[model samples]
Target: MAALACSPADLLPLLGGNATSAAAEYICGRFDAVSSKFVDTGYAVDNTYLLFSTYLVFSMQIGFAMLCAGSVRAKNTMNIMLTNVLDAATGSFFYYLFGFALAFGTPSNGFIGQHFFGLSKFPSQSFDYGFFLFQWAFAIAAAGITSGSIAERTQFGAYLIYSSFLTGLVYPIASHWFWSADGWASPARADNLLFGSGVIDFAGSGVVHMVGGIAGLWGALIEGPRIGRFDHSGKPVTLRGHSATLVVLGTFLLWFGWYGFNPGSFLNILKAYGVSGSYYGQWSAIGRTAVTTTLAGSTAALTTLFGKRVLVGHWNVTDVCNGLLGGFAAITAGCAVVDPWAAILCGFVAAWVLIGFNKLAEKLKYDDPLEAAQLHGGCGAWGLLFTGLFAKQAYVNEVYPGVENRPYGLFMGGGGGLLAAQVVQILVVAAWTSVTMGTLFFILHKMKLLRISHEEEVAGMDLTSHGGLAYEFEAEEKKEISF
Candidate 1:
């Protein structure tokens, strides 16, 4: 039940003139008790919803592990899987230590947050434990994306250094710039919005996806391609993963987790659209967001299916899987505010965008084993652009309330202000990630900590660094028959 907005004095008119003070006091006390219960119930519901969403988001880590394992050579399978696991573990400690503060601590400057260090005075009226857990899940996901790009040849020590830096500093700063209420580009900002329309990255298309992708781009570039990635004549070589089944499984898992990724961004579900008893409210919006997310991914998968068939003269499940992910990444930014039909367009364009980026990477001899840079970075940029072009005015108002006449999608008749802001987001995210992560990779390269030795690369990091190969099959000796 919604909390009642009545006081004892307001209720006086309902009582007869002969009503006694004792009667009024009794009635008011009862009203207060009921209102308190309602408030408590609301909190309980919201917290429960958030906690469940956090679990869903956390499960994406497992999906990432399976995906990375299936996307790399079997020799490096253990190495890649280990990094994904650490992304969650290390990301948790660092994000709890200071990442949350840098991204959400309020009463600070717009550029960065400064409060809530180590969760001091935590579970306040404004922030709670559930919120922190949800954000932590997102932080690890960024690290997971970068791990894929530099897989197969990266040093384990290098992975630790970069993952910590990214979760604790780089990703937090970028998220603060867009997701924090006090951020300069946040639509939730109370005043002085960017271009009178803040960047509408509803679910971190730029903050998470672009940052991870760009960081991966630099890491892979600095490390150079894996051994045997290209020939002496510069012809690209195919380094297919050992298992396609794992790729399909991982893709489906990611698809399931996206329900939490996009809709869960609401942070609360008990809010009503206008009145408490109304059938339409935030719950309805959440359902719409889920629908849009599904449509975009589905459309992109089908588009890639046919598109790849034409390009390569064959139906490639791996290519389709990547295309499906590209669509999800692109639609994430606008899922809540766009119509379902618009999501289809977003997914369709995202498929081609992934294909185009893949072609460009091949031409440039840029090798990302799982296409993390091209799929996440390239398609992520397009997702932001799609939001700027398709977000609906009514939905925008509903999602980012208290902002009147805010500019929406340019193609939706709102104007170019929102689109311009999105473009700015793309540029700033690219520049920031390149400068920070690119420098880190460069230093690691110079210090001989980024890429493994050629010997390790040829033999695979699983064998050289991870104790042994991921899979070992040997014939048993005749002596085993004694057992």
Candidate 2:
């Protein structure tokens, strides 16, 4: 049954209060009296934003396609392209079929959603179509994160199954716990030792990136490194992305898309409100969120540039790109609650942590081709923790108020409770995702559906899997070397 409401503008009239009407206007932003009567109009705008965000997020596919194709050996060029393409197609279908239902189904007991396979009942009803599209963008991004990880040797058929399971079951289920209304990870809940302060992954530290990256890690381990990525002595050899330009472009696209990803979290941005006559209400908060997100991204980019010189003796594009992503991911949790300066700290530390984790992942032999493990998994975890540390009292009070507000971070003088809550969240999400993804990999490995034959890998997936090459060098090379 739908919840009937007087026009948001008419709220004051119904309640017979001037303060309430003034508060309603402030909270409603661009929506007016007539606008309040038509809930679907607001939904329409969100849907449009959702579509625009999807377009932005999906653009990363081109960035990844270019970046991944250019990164691996030419022999595997087509293979990379095929993997990127299929993952998007198959992942979208699977997400639509059951993923949305699992992740965003109507709440049940404030834990897991109870809808069955696909969007059986909801799509036909008065559903938020815009929100659905925005979520679809996330599903695609999650699938793409693993493309770089399993690029060279993963079998096309195996990847198809992997994409389906990940988008439909794995990623969706995790996202449900963190972002959905009744999810275990919902920020609205009180802290529980078993689940932590519901999981504060504002933009999917564990939901999208880590889930995909860890799955990639498991796939990498089960399949072993690309035949030549590591030598017989177990030392890694250097491999270059075919085009540095593609990598930079991909990074920029991701950064741009993140604006939509984070600020759009308040799906019904135009409808949120605070106490009567309060200025620090819904619309005000969302505007602040946008500003903090941008600050974090820019600061992270600068810090990564500086860190590269200190650590690697040169400024590397890949480091800067991933640094920005790490910063964005790290700030995601606090974007809505932390002040602008906190975002800078979040960005700076996030870059430093990303550089450190990159080295650690390399030393540990994770064989994360895209370093997705560090960019998303390591940094994603950092983002969640950063939120616990930086979340503020004013913002927290305004957003959550009263009962919904949890303990403040240590920096905010709330004590160690918030930090401990974060730690619990990290452990549980990590364990659940890792165990589930690892088991799936093991099963696929045992069935011999994990990797391609050495010959196919060497020849390139374009020809082997998709029956064509992405590029043909039949003509003479135009050698105009740039200095």
Candidate 3:
């Protein structure tokens, strides 16, 4: 062994000191150099992951646009597409101006962030740029989700305003409370340890999807459903969209996008204080979370397909897509913490949640075009609660280390405390979204800027709002026939 491991440190004695002293100094210097290299390399590797993941998340905007455009009337397709594009653009501007700072800047009594405005707080040599970019993707996603529920009749100018506040103020404040280190809702920052790690939302079921879902409900109410959505007798009319083919295509795109949404939520497992010697980047919860996300969506899709057939005497394509999305929303909060089997359960049950809430929304005379109220709002709540019930203690430990008092599932013998905290989390998130988005829509409604005129609504937004239809092929075909 001695022959095999020659003491390279012994050569340091030629510089000045005795072999023992020089060896010790040389080893210490090398240790420092290696450690510095480790930190720098880790940062680069992790930041690259964040940047790529954020790009994937940004692609979901295209998914949202396609989904909403297919779900609306053909005449309004261009309007939906245009609004979706502008949603990202407008939300990005506002988020860059102040949203990132408000969510992640220096803590201000755990209420709001107070730095990073104009990117000033982003260090020249820090990983913060990737973090901000990833977070901006999330901010825009939340705003874009709201567009689907209130489609067909919403005024373009009003939607832009909605995007600005949702990305800049409302969503950021909620993000601060749940995601920031010093926020009151953080399990890590909670003053009371009894609350089970401060409401463990691995992703942003409550922070992102829930906010958008609630905003959608408010917009539906303030805009008072599309024209002829309900008859004189207040009976609902099923106004089918122009393209089931497009709807199916859009659902698949969203499913692909959610791989980025759920797994990417981990940001990076190479984060500081991660698994020891995990420099090769093999060890991470990302794989498991990705599996859970896939299982949840797949399970919910199959479950809804059969369940809807039994309940309605036939299969509905739209409900199938809603179930798929509901499953994704449900698993999001607990994907990193729950077992694969538990994720299956979450998805299966989330399908029913979507159905129930869709029925509830219809009963209340609220028309949600893409079932946003059910798929996101209802399943977002269920996802949070399901995490409390099914989260594994070991998985929680892996995600959040160094905490002896972390959370575990109720079924795992951790008592009802974690479940209780999850309930409070759901309620608080719902209330916050309701208050903020409701107020925004209400003020917009009072100003008469929220909806288009009745004539404009019937005339079709593509022609009335955008001065053209999305598919000119139909007109061209007709022209050829007439000739």
Best by lDDT: 1
List residue ranges in candidate 2 displaced over 4 A: 1-47, 109-111, 123-126, 189-197, 272-281, 401-405, 474-483
- Runs in model 3 deviating more than 4 A are 1-35, 124-127, 190-196, 271-284
**Every candidate's lDDT:** 0.92, 0.73, 0.83
lDDT of 2 at 5: 43
Clashing pairs in 1: none
Candidate 2 local accuracy as lDDT? Answer: 0.73
* lDDT rank order: 1, 3, 2
User: Tens digits of per-residue lDDT for model 3 on 188-280?
Assistant: 574654365777887888888888888888898888888888888888889888888778888888788777777877777564334556543
- Model 1 scores a C-alpha lDDT of 0.92
Write the residue-wise lDDT of candidate 2 on 303-358 in tens digits.
Answer: 99987888779988877777887888778777888899999998898888888877
Q: In the order shown, what is each candidate's alpha-carbon RMSD?
A: 2.0, 6.3, 4.1
Clashes of each: 0, 11, 2
lDDT of 1 by residue, 146-216 (tens): 99999998999999999999999999989999999999899999798998889999988899999999999
C-alpha lDDT (0 to 100) for residue 422 of candidate 3: 82
Candidate 3 has its poorest 10 consecutive residues by lDDT at 1-10
RMSD of 1: 2.0
TM-score of each: 0.97, 0.85, 0.92
Candidates 1 and 2 compared: the better one by lDDT is 1
